[model samples]
Target: MAETRTFDVVVLGGGSGGYATALRAAQLGLTVALVEEGKLGGTCLHRGCIPTKALLHAAEVADAARESETFGVRATFDGIDMAALAAYKDGVVAGLYKGLQGLVSARGITLVEGHGKLVSPDTVEVGGERYTGRNVVLATGSYSRTLPGIEIGGRVITSEQALELDYVPRSALVLGGGVIGVEFASVWRSFGADVQVVEALDHLVPAEDLAVSKALERAFRKRGIGFTLGDRFASVAETDSGVRMTLESGKTLDAEVLLVAVGRGPRTAGLGFEEQGVRLDRGFVVVDERLHTGVGNVYATGDIVPGLQLAHRGFAQGIYVAEQIAGLEPAPIDESGIPRVTYSDPEVASVGLTEQAARERFGDDAVETLDYNLAGNGRSKILATQGFVKLVRRKDGPVVGVHLVGARVGELVGEAQLIVNWEAHPEDVAALVHAHPTQNEALGEAHLALAGKPLHAHN
Candidate 1:
């Protein structure tokens, strides 16, 4: 016997996308039911984004303390206290979780706690109870993926296990040179681990602008973090202490631990989505521009929807879907219009097209760029970080792309995104004065150079 319940909207999963959809739907005067089998904030809050950032920040604090003498500060650099750091990170998560719970409760969104399986296009079944809604949302999110013939146990672990480490390994071999791989590699290197990154691609963070990849490699090298570029990972075997990896170049590397920083796959297995006529490509839910599925009133968002796989992107998509279901007819989101940031050492942030991408899209003759060095930025110089701001634009038109690399550069991406989204011309950005002696001035300086003003730059 199954209990029956009904709502105006039913959201599957309680992650970033799911929660956002539920919240927005409830706010729109829809009775929403949010179902979850785990903690609410999902991977970003519990494991992925929040905890990793806390670790990165801890690493930052350690680096700052270790290099305090350069800043004329008399401070002794001590090793990390893993227990305290974990507590601080967990505390931040807990407080935020409490706030989120309060928010959902106040909005009158029904919080159904269980694993939900879509029994029909309009119904989700959990614990032998049926929850029905006029509209259904699938936001099951994703899980860290492992490669074929790769076993994740003991010393070989994914990002989930890496986030909960009680002690940093003495040496680490990280597979994949993308965002997750580079981020963990950066954190480990900062924590005094002998790290070697293996990327099958040509460079680390390969999806970013090539200049950014080169800059990151340079920075990591200067920090003594070793990596193999333009090589393929052939095989890996568990050793007595850790693991041994062989590359296609016939090079063998050993480390105390091997981190599989490959990537994530949508967690859509056995959820009954396909059984309900919802289309799926591989494991990802198929959705159109409006986030609607093949089944009537069924929609999908977040990592399961086969786009950016970013939490913020999930939030945006979720809100958009909610509004769409409410008949608000919200404007569709352009996938490429989203901002992306890699929170590694000498962080990489970008919005709009890459340099090569811009050239391809608008043609090489139409695309022009200016690279503004951080050496010209007083704040960056004071911070003793090295990198640059590279802006791409049409030869005589608006800025098309902005790429940034250096310490704390991720914080400046908001303005860069606005410039790209609004299609502001170099002259338009150049006319505006950024506050002096700030890293943000790097963006302004790049625009100045692009506009042929060439302040603080060699043209």
Candidate 2:
């Protein structure tokens, strides 16, 4: 026996994207149903962003204790307690999950707890019951990806297993030097593990500005983290003690754990997406500027849609889709304006074009750049952090990009995003007063240097 219920919007996948879509649609006075096979808040809350950051914070605490003498604080460097650390991370996630549940419930959005499959463009079936909507949103999210012929089990693991480890390995070999790989490497190194990273690209965090990537590499090397760049992975074998990885260069590296952090693939197969006329390009939903799937009243958001794959990006897309469904005609998202932050030892944050990208788009001669060293910032000196704020702009026009690397630099991205998104000129930003001895002042100083004032920097 199957029952049919209809709503104004039926969102599949109760992750950041789907839940956000449901929340905003409900707020706009549209009836909504949110389906999930797992808990609400999805990977970002449970497996990806939230839990990983907790681990990183614990790692920071460990590093602080180990380096307390540098700050004139007498403290003993102790080992990590796996049980306590897990409990703390789990506690943080539990609190957020509870809060999200309450918010969804309060919004009067129907929360369907089951595996949902799109039986048609406007209808999803869960446990033989069909939930139909005037419009449907696909936000199935993504799963951890691994190289071909490489198995993830026993000593070989993914980020999910890495998060649930009961003991810290003496050594770890992380494949992929992107955000996930570098982050786990940072955490393990802080927890007293020797880490080696493998990247098929020339630089770590290769998608970032070349300057930021090079700075991060220097920082990692200074911290004793070894890496093999420009080499691809060939095969991995389970050893008696741990695992052994052989690179394409025929170099063999043995470690207590092999973390396959290549990337994530969209979770869009066997879910009736194509059957419902939704076009998928290499497992990602193909959508227009407004997120329409070119299908009947169907829209897709989040990792499945294949742009940034960030949880925050998913949130924004979900809100946009909801507004569009409500006929609010919200403006399309400027993908370049979205902020990106990598939460590692020396955090990397950026918005808008990179120097290379700006040069390619606006020409090298048309762009001017400035690097404001954190060495000159009062707050950076206080924290003993090393990095810089790199700004790229039109020769005499507006700031086109903002890239930052150093401790707690990710926190400064909100203002950086605003500066780039609003197309603020270096002169305009330079005129603003920033609080003295704050990290944000670094941004001001960078803008000042770019505006030809050269405060705290050589011209």
Candidate 3:
């Protein structure tokens, strides 16, 4: 016999978007049900962002141990206990999981642990139970995509296994040059593993402005990270001792472990979207500007929405959709307002239009830019991190974009996002008081230089 249930909102996939929506909706006095087969906190807390970053931080520690001499400090790292690392990762994950559960429970949100599939436009079937809601949010999230010829084995793996690796391999072949792949490469290389990255794109972090791409390549080269960019994967095969890969150029590379991190695909398979007539294209949920699926009362958000597979982006989408359903004043997501950060040794964070993008949109003469090197910045020198603060602007108004690469620069993106989205003029930012001796002060100085008021920098 089929069971039945009802709620004001049903959120499928208890990831960032789903849980956030359920909590917020319940906060608004709406009855909500959040369904998931696995533990909460989704991939970000489980195998993706959170765990991967934990491992990366471990790698950074390993690098710091090796470089303690530079700071006139003595330190030595004997070895990495896989058990200890995994336990540390698990602790971080468990703490967040507990917090999420508390949040959901305190709000009186019902959480059903089962694999949910849509039976109708507004209904989901899980554990033989039928749950219907006025608004259905499908935030199924995404999975890492592998090449057709490549099969992920114990030795050849994706980010999922890389997070839970039993032992760090002596050598690793990272098969993509995207954000995730490069990050892992940096981690592995820092951990004293031989790491090589291969990418089909012409430059690493290829989606960034070309100069940004070139700058990263230079920084990566300085760190001794080997790469084969502008090369396509021919095939992957398992050897008796290791894994081997051949590029389209007929060049071959071998390593004890192979990681495929090209990109991730929407988790839209066999979730009953087809029977419900939900639209999908290129493995992503098809949606209009409002994020509505073809089926009535069925909507999707986050990685499933198809642009910029970011957890925070999904956070915005979930809030917007819930507001739209509740007849509240809702604003469409400004996609460019979403900040992006690459967690590498030299981190990359950017928001809004790139210099070229601003130029193309507003014209060459309309766009002016100031490239401020971190060499002159006090904080960058103190942290031993090198990069630049790029300020993009129009002659008479708004700072268009800010791109950064350095240690902990991701934290500064909040200010950049505000400048870009609020349409704050360069002078407006420049005239504002920024705390002395901070990396963010560089942003203010860059703005001042762009606005024809030079302070702490020569233009």
Candidate 4:
């Protein structure tokens, strides 16, 4: 029999949410046990966010070199060095993982290196050892999902395999045109691969605002990225050379590799969650607004929860849960206020309700929208990026949504989130100053137009 342990909080799966909960709970002077089957920083640090973003950055650098003549630096456009790129991406992940390990150690949190399962609401069993705590947080994170009858191996792959590929394919077919799909497609295209995306939806990044999606589609088309929208994937077969895919509409396509980027599903199965009396909806842990499972002090956060599967969202929920356990009574998280970004070239970033959603909820008469073209912004012109900042607000009321599509637009989501979360009126945002000759100025310009004081744009 293994020895038993006790802590104030026992967090299962040391992914973003699990480690974050342990760190914050320990900061509040609570004894914490963070269990993991793998590395501490979890998928985000090792596989998902960090490594993927590093790839995107590399793609950006490739694009810069390929288009350097536009900037008049007289640089030669060379192909990507896969070995060096892998090394660079791995270096970034390794540095962050090391720092996270150091932080966990310094915080005096017990790092249990094993797969943990909830034997009871308050007890987690790992390696035949029981760790009991007053509170337990489930944050097992997520895994890449595949379609029915479509196995991921060899020529057919998911984002995980795509990230670690030794060589870019001559041509690739990406299934699903959502965030992950479009991002991978963008990276491959910039790396000089002939990339074609097939989305079941009508547009790329369909979850984003319609205008933003349309803009992204146009940009992708201009970049020579081929896509077949509104087409459902029927089947895929591995060929001697690559993959051959057939759509539900009886269309056939072939590529050197087929990337199945149909998004991710929460990793919760056979881990004793249901046996422990925690409720689950379609494999997602059911939690209240406070993230509590309503099953004996057990809570769920991150991808395990049914909301946004963003790493940052997971981090925020972990902190909230820790504070709640410490009697801080933190306010519940607002799902819509969370920022969303797709890190493809000509990235899309948004916060709050999308224009269509806002109108659907508040009625068309209650909603008004303004689109400020980035073409009018000096910085955008300099970057040679074409897109817009769109603002959606209640007629004569607060700004309800902010959507942006352009190069480096993801960085502007912080302010957009602040505006929507605070329910700031268009006039309120317009009253503030945005520095000239910056992509950020496009946001301010949109607000100014919405506030009925257009600058650098037509009213």
- Measured against the true structure, the TM-scores of the candidates, in listed sequence, are 0.98, 0.99, 0.97, 0.99
Tens-digit per-residue lDDT, 1-459, candidate 4: 777888999999898898889999999999999999999988899878899999999999889988898999877767989999999999999899899999999999999998888999899999899999989999999999999989989999998899899998999999999999999999999999999999998999989999999999999999999999998989999888899999999999999999999989989998999998999899999988889998999999999999789999999999999999999999998999999999998999999999889989999899999888888889999999988888989999999999999999999999999999999999898899999878988888788888888866534
For 135-171, candidate 1 gives per-residue lDDT tens digits of 9999999999988867898888999999888998999
Better model by lDDT, 1 or 2? 2
Worst lDDT run of 10 residues, candidate 4, spans 450-459
Residue 314 Cα positional deviation in candidate 1, in Å, after optimal superposition: 0.1
| TM-score of structure candidate 1 | 0.98
The residue-level lDDT of candidate 3 at 251 comes to 96
Q: Which pairs, if any, clash in model 1?
A: none
- Deviation in angstroms for 431 in model 3? 1.0
lDDT of 1: 0.91
Output the lDDT of residue 134, model 1.
94
Which candidate leads the pack in lDDT? 2
lDDT of 2: 0.95
Cα RMSD of all models vs. native, in order, equals: 1.1, 0.8, 1.4, 0.9
lDDT by residue for model 2 (300-377), tens: 999998789899999999999999999999999999999999999999999999999999999989999989899998
Where in model 1 is the C-alpha error above 4 Å?
Answer: none
For model 3, where is the 10-residue window of minimal lDDT?
450-459
Residue 212 in candidate 2, Cα distance off native in Å: 0.6
Local distance difference test, each candidate: 0.91, 0.95, 0.87, 0.92
